[model samples]
Target: MVKKGRPDKRSKTRSQAAGGGGGALPSGELIGPFDRTLLYLAVFLTGAAIMMIEVLGTRILGPFYGVGLFVWSSLISVTLIALALGYYLGGIAADRAKRFQLSHGIALAALATALIPVFKTPVLLQTNALGVRAGAFTSALLLFSVPLTLLAMVGPRVIKLCTSRLESVGRSAGSVYAFSTVGSVLGTLVLGFFLLPMMGTRTILYGVSVGLLVLAAVLALYERARRNTLGLLVLPFVSLAIAGLLFFLGGDRLPSTPGFTTVYEAQSIYGRVRVVDESERQIRWLLSDSSTIGAIDLRTGEPEFPYLYILEALPRFHPRGRSALLIGLGAGQLPKLLGRYGIETDSIEIDPEVARAAKDYFGFNHPGRLILGDARYEVRRLRKKYDFIIHDCFSRGVVPAHLLSVEMLQDLRSLLNDGGILALNFYGYAEGPQALPAAAVAKTIEAVFPFHRVFVSSLQTELTDHVFFASTEPVEFKADKVDIAPSPLGKLMLDNLFRYEHKISSDQGFVITDDFNPLDSMQVRKAEIYRHQVLSDISADLLAR
Candidate 1:
C-alpha cells in the first residue's frame, strides 16, 4: 500500500516518540530537533507580541484620544475580530500548502511591528481628527489589525507543521496554545513592570523588531540549503530602512509656546508626565496624560489656579485649624499654601512620579506633607483628624468616580474634626448638559453633609472650576464684609467670592453612590465636546502663528 521512494509513517512515529529526534517529512524537507525547538519559540513569541501590542496600544493612543473606556473597548474588539479572521485564513493556507512554514508569518509580523513607529503619528492624528469613537476604532484597525492577524496565523500554521498524524492533532494544538498563553502572561508582567518604565515606547518596539528579525535569520539559516539566499541578504537592509523611516517621521510637532520649553518628560505606569516652562510669563506647567494638572507663576510664589483661592475663604468659617489634609497633590501648591498659613498639611498623591515631578519642577519640597498612594485607601487608613480636608483628585477632565461617591464623602467626614471644613474642587458646565456631572456630585455630597455651599471659580465662565465648601457648622461667604486685599492674586480671590451660590439638590437626577456610579458615562457627551474644543484650540493656535 506504500508508495515507492516515500518515507514510511514509522519514521514519523519514531521521531515524534523520541521527543526531539530527526522527523521525516511526508512532503520533502527534514526537521531536526533544533528545527522543532525553533517552531515552539516562534509560537511563544507570537503570542507574547500580541498581548504586548494590545497593552502598549493604550499608551500610544492615550495622549491624543485618552485611555478611557471607549479607546479600550475599541482596541479589544478590533484585536478579537482580527484574530478570528487570521485563524480561519491560516487553516485554509495550511491545507493548500505542501508544508507549513511559520518563519514567513513571524518575519511579516516583525516587519509590521517595525513599521508601527513610522506610521503612528500620521495615522493617529488623521484618525483622531475624525472624532474619538470613530478615531479610536479606525486607529486601532490601522495600527494593530494587520500585525495581530499575522501573529494569530502563526499558531495554526505551527500546529499544522508539528502534527504528523490525525491522532496527534489534539496534543499538537494544546501544546502550541499552552506555550502561547504562557508567553503572553510573561510579556504582560515583564513589559509593564520592567521594560515600559525603563525604555521609551519606540525603543521597546524596536527591540521587539530586532528579536523577531533574529528569530527569522536563524530560521532562514536552517533552510539556507533551499536557496533562499537573496531574501536573507535583503532582510538587514529592510530593517535599516524601517528604523530610518521612524527617525524621520516619529518626531512630535505641536504648536510652540512663545517662550516655553519642555523641562522634563517621562512615561510612568500612571501616564505621561511633562513639565514645561513659560519664561515670558514666568509660569511652569505640570501636565499629566496630556492635561494640565497645575501651573505656577514663578514671579509670585502663589498658586495661579483660581479655584485654589477657595482656601483663602476657609479660615472665615473654621478659624482655628491646626492641621489640614489635602488629597491629590497637584504640583503641591495647595499644601505649600497651607504650610504658609502655619497649618500642618498632609497630602496624598496616587502617582509617585507626579509627586516627584511636583517636587523637582514646582518646588513642592515641603517637609512631612507627601504621602504616596491612593487617596481613598490612605484617607480611610488615617487615624488622625484634620481641621480642613481638601478633595482635589482628578484624572484628565473628570474626578475619579471612586472619590466622588457618597461613601467616600462619609469617610471624609469621619476624618474631619468636630467643626472641620471640607473643600472640593470640581469642573463642569453651569447650565448645559455638562452641568449634570457637577449636579450629581453636589447631590452625593449633600447626601452625606447637610451643610454645603457652591462657589464658581469665575462668575463669567460657564464650564469651569466650581469649589464646594461643606462643614457641619454653618458656613458663610461674607464677600461684602471682608476687607478686599490689594495684591492681584488676592483681588482675583475676592472677585470670585461674589459668585458664591447655594448648592442645588439632585433629588430628581442621578446620585453617584459606590454601588451604582456611571461617572464616565455621564461625562461622555461633555468629553466629546471638550475633546473637539481642545483639538480646535490647538489647531487655531498653530494656524494663527
Candidate 2:
C-alpha cells in the first residue's frame, strides 16, 4: 500500500519531475521554461524552412528538367510524401523513453540542408539524363526527400515536448501547429516576394542552412548550460564548419556544354537567365530556362536566329505601319529593325533582367518604349491601336496558355487597326502527331481573324518555327525592293523566306479557349521529345570530342 507521507520510487520521481517547475526535464536534465520557448521557436523555423525549400526546389530543378506541368507535379508530390513519412516516424519516436531532443534532429537537418547545393548539380544531371517524367520524379525524390523528412519531424517532436499531461495535450498541439502554420505563411511571403528575386539559389540555400545552424547553437548552449555537459555543445559548430566546407568545395557551375563560355548568368524571378558565347560560331545565345531565346552574330551585330529573319518579312505584308507593337523582346532584334525603319515601336518584356542583359551584353539599344510587365495585362491597357503586332513570346518553346486562348486572340485582334497584320512565331511540327499545337493555334486565330496564313521556317525539319500571319484583309507577301540597300545577308534571308513558307489548314483542330485550354498537356509529349533530343545532342557533342 502507498503511504500519504512518503511514496514509492516511481511515484516520487514523477512528483519531482512534474512539480520541479522551471527545472530539469523528465529525462534527468534541466530544460526550463526559457528552453521550452526556444524549442517552440525552433519548431516555427523548421516549418518555414520546409516550405521555403519546397518553393525554391522548383527553381533549382527548372534549368535541367524544365518547369513543366509534370515536373511541378512531381515536386509537390515528393514534398507531401516526405512530410507524411516524417510525421509518422516522429510520432513513433516521440513515444520512446528519451522523448524529443530538439538539438539533435535540428543540427542534423541543418547539415543536410547545407549539403543540397553541394550535391544538387551532379544529382540533377544524373537524374535528368534519365529523360523527362522519370528524371523530374527522381530528381525531386533524391534531392529533397531526406532533408524535408527530417525538417518535418520537428513539428510532431515539438508537440510531444511541449505537453506534460493528457489535459494540456490538445492546447499544446494546437499552439504548436498554429505557430508553425503562421511561420509557413510568413516564410512563403518573404521568400517569394523578397529573397528569391534578389538572391541566387546557392546564396538562398546557404543562408537557410546558416539560419538553422544558429538556432541549433542556441539550443545546444542552453542544453549544455542546464545539463552542465560541455562536450556535446561542439556539434552545432561542427555542422556549421562542414556546411562551410561543402559550399567552398562545390560551388554552382553554369549549366552548359563544352566549347560554350558563360558570359552572363543570374537567377531571376521568372527563371534562370544565361548568356552563352559559342566560340566556334562567333555567336552569343540568350538562354532562359535552358532554351535558346535568340542568338546574335558577334561580328555583324545582326540576329543570327533563322526564325527572327523569317519574321523580318513582317513589314512587307502590311506597309501602312508607322506604329507597331511587339509583344515579346528577346535581344530586341525585331524591335531594333522596326526602330531602324523609323516606326514608332513599343515593346513588352516581362523580365527586367532579360531587358537589362539585352542592353548590357546583346547591344539591344532599340529606339522605342520598352514597357515592362506581362503582355496579357499590358495589351488590355493600351490606348492606341497598332498597324502591326508581333506575338513572339515563348518560355522554352511553350507559349503561356493564357496568351493563346481564344479570348486573348480576340483581345489582340481588337488592338489592331483595319488591314493591320499580326505575326506569331510558334515552334512545333506542322504535320503528324506534333501538328496538334500548331493546328489548335491556327483554329483559334482563324476564329478571330477571317484571313490567316501559316509559314514553316523549314519543311524538312521535324520541329521548326512556324510563323503565323493574320490580317483583317487578305494578306500577301511583297519582297522588299532590290534598291533598298539592305545587308547582303539580310537580302538573302528575305529572298529565301518565301521558299520556306508553307500553309496550315485551320479546319484540322479544335479552338483553344481560356476555360478548356490543354496546350500544356498537349505539349508534354513534344517537350519530352525535345528533352531527349537535347540529351542526345549533348552526348554526341561530348563523344565527338
Residue pairs that clash (backbone atoms under 3 angstroms), model 1: none
User: TM-score for every candidate vs. truth?
Assistant: 0.85, 0.90
Model 1 lDDT tens row, 1-545 = 78999988987666553332121133433456775687888778878888888888877776667678778899999899989988987776665643334455667777888787677767876776577888888988998898899889877767766765556779989998999898899888888999887766666777777677677666656545444445543554465466547645655443355565667777787766767676767877776654568888878767777777766666556657768888998888876666655677889999777888998888887755678888889988999999999988875454588898888999999999988889998877767666878888888877878788888766675667778888887776544443434246755676557656535556534668889998888777666765665454333222111
Backbone clashes in model 2, listed as residue pairs? 24-30
**Number of clashes recorded per candidate:** 0, 1
Model 2 off-target regions past 4 Å? 1-24, 27-36, 97-100, 248-257, 480-489, 533-545
lDDT, model 2: 0.76
C-alpha lDDT of residue 150 in model 1: 83
Global lDDT of each model?
0.73, 0.76
lDDT of 2 by residue, 217-289 (tens): 8877876776677755678889988888877876766545676777788878788777878777888878676
